[model samples]
Target: MDDRKTLVLTGASRGIGHATVKRFSEAGWRIITCSRHPFSDKCPWPAGEEDHIQLDLADPDGLGTAIADIRARLAANGGRLHALVNNAAISPKGEGGTRLNSIETPMHLWRAVFQVNFFAPIMLGRGLVKELKAARGSVVNVSSIAGGRVHPFAGTAYATSKAALAALTREMAADFGPLGIRVNAIAPGEIDTAILSPGTEALIDDIPLRRLGSPKEVAEAIFFLCSDASSYVNGAEIHVNGGQHV
Candidate 1:
């Protein structure tokens, strides 16, 4: 029997998602990654092309097709999915990368944000429940510190979508627990990524750590939640912000 674990991760092209792909791949886990862009020839991961899926999670129709395609790919793993990480998200900004407040954010953009950040996770989870159950899988939703409180950089749409994702994580944990599946969330703060705004450096001094968090740090927390170390942990939202929440 092929006992190697498998993970289905979204948004694996960059930042925390990229770090996560490296972490799991190094651990000898088979990784299936989803992204809006096609697999790049320069991708460093092994079997990157074959294991990569081009998916636009915002389109419900496209997502449905992608789900089926993902299931087909999982057949080689005996229809087992050890982990599902809903890490793809979008944070739209105005000109000069300014925050888009509630009043100014367009309705289309707000809905688009929700579609990717909120709806996609649930849709993918529901679509892959069978595979998840087969492997007694863990699901990790990537949220943000902005979900709980206002942040200067994170826009209104992005913040609300993450908050919704956090809520959905708790609800999924309750519903999936009995099936031997775990669901959790990680709320990150001020991570050093391209997603950060131009003025992010100014806020670092206010952070308790007095520095920005690395993508690898967040990936480590995610690895823990998906691994046996967090077997009993469910419906929990772990904070990856270095005491910034305090």
Candidate 2:
């Protein structure tokens, strides 16, 4: 029997998610990743195909299907789940990667952003509650520095969705604490990833670090929240933005 811990992570194709997978996998955790794309042979991890779940979080029905699939996979461990990282998110941009403000953004896009960023996290937490309780697991929701303030590149819908996710993290912590589950959030700023919009370098001077954060840096914080080191931490949002929030 595989006695190693198990983690379910979303948006594992690249960037922060990819870094997170490497972080936990190095610590000998079994990773079950979810992404819109199918398992790629390019992935360095072993059993990548068998452990990857191809599902679009933006689709409500697909998310339900993914949850069922995950639960079945967890059955091997008597329904124990050590960690769940809600990291999949979509930031819609206008022509030439222009920011889409609240008024100018279409209703469909707003709903789509919310479905992926906000609704998916809560739904996943609710769906996996039993497994989490059995393992006394932790949940880490990926938020954004834009969630708290207006970012020059992050769109309005994306920012609002992350804000809602942050709030949901707090609510989930309160409700899941009694079950021995911890819930928290991480807000990243100006991370050097594909998700960053063009002209982001201009904001680096304003940050105290005078540089963009690495995806590994954010992954480290997520790892801490999921591990025993953060056992007493709950309902908190850690800033991985190199003093950008200040």
Candidate 3:
């Protein structure tokens, strides 16, 4: 059996997810990725292309199959999963850069957002608790600043789902702590990603950092939470938002 650590990361094709794959891979950990899209050569990380699993988390259907496939892949390797990063998220918006607040956000859209941002993490974490325990692993959930406060650009469904995900991190930590598993979350502020709309640049001055955070910064925070350096940390959220919340 291989002695290297292993990570199962969602949304690994781009942005922070891609950076995280690079970070862990360079550290000699095996990475298994899940994304809505099929494996693309554009990513080209070590062993990442071959281990990609295509599944749309927002669909909220056939999660059982995803969990099974993930478990099977882990078993095929070393049967130990060191980290599960819930990085997949979806935030829908209308035309002209409008906000989909609580009242205007449709029920179907709300469900889809929650299914991807919140519920999917819950399912994946709990489903693989056994593997995590075997490895004394940690789970890092990707949250957002919108989760803790109202943001003009982020949709209500997206914000609330993240808040719920943060709460779930606490719950998972409390439940899994006895089993030697730690669960934490990182909430990113204004980051430069395809998800950020064109008009978002105007808000840059408000950030203490005076610039949008890079995906690499967020990935480094996630890496800390998954590493022995953060062994004493659990059920907490590290904000990588450059003092946006403060």
Candidate 4:
């Protein structure tokens, strides 16, 4: 029953996930970050400690093993895991892009999108339920506004998967509430992340704010849900989309 707050962050190598890790670190929470690639040598964050683990969320075969390793780390550090952020996702690539009506949206692409967006988060949440229960922790699934809207830019698979994730958030919140575990989601609008491919200028213009969101802004919302500040907030979907979803 160590009193120190610990957070397990996925996709922490960059983007919103990276920003969240930095914020939590500054707030004095011990971080266990996961990424497919090793952090760059120039990574200024204090992730050099033994808590960082490299894991590929898209690799379904390795998901169980990765979760086990994370659980082991928590056990070794003292049975404490305050939060889990399921933020790892892959935007569709190539000529298909993420356009909803694109003829190029193949079954393989759809599968890939669901694999990382939907399956990974569900698997990670189920695997870490015990640790989350131990700390009465929350699970925050990073989703997109495209899930709720019919956006041509988001494509079919990406939007559909995110929509499913939103539903999953509600279900998890309901199921885990009695155990003192909270589940929530953040549906970001258009974040200025590298996830969006180049030549997508038109897509940026469609945003009502006329600009992309900063990763730190999204991170702040996530931090709120992770902390006691949002203790009463459960099964909630906070939109950080600059009024796009409104």
- Pairs clashing in candidate 4? 98-155
* Residues 84-175, model 4: lDDT tens digits: 99998876755545354446678988888899999999899889889999888999999889889877577778888999999999999999
TM-score-best of 2 and 4: 2
Candidate 3 lDDT by residue in tens digits, 1-246: 768899999999889998899899988998989999899888757776678889988665677788889898889766789999999999999778789999999999998998999999999998999899999999999999999999989999999999999999999999999999999999999989877877789888889888999999999999999999999999999999888888
Better by lDDT, candidate 4 or 2: 2
TM-scores, each model vs. reference: 0.98, 0.98, 0.97, 0.91
Number of clashing pairs, model 2?
0
Reference-based lDDT, each prediction = 0.94, 0.94, 0.91, 0.85
Model 4 CA deviation exceeding 4 Å by range:
1-3, 96-103, 199-210
Q: Write the per-residue lDDT of candidate 1 for residues 175-206, one digit (tens) a residue.
A: 99999999999999989987678888998878
lDDT of 2 by residue, 40-62 (tens): 88777767799999999999999
| Best model number under TM-score | 2
- Global CA lDDT of candidate 2, please? 0.94
Which of the predicted structures, 1 or 2, would earn the higher TM-score when compared with the native?
2
lDDT of 3 at 176: 94
User: Which stretches of model 3 miss by more than 4 angstroms?
Assistant: none
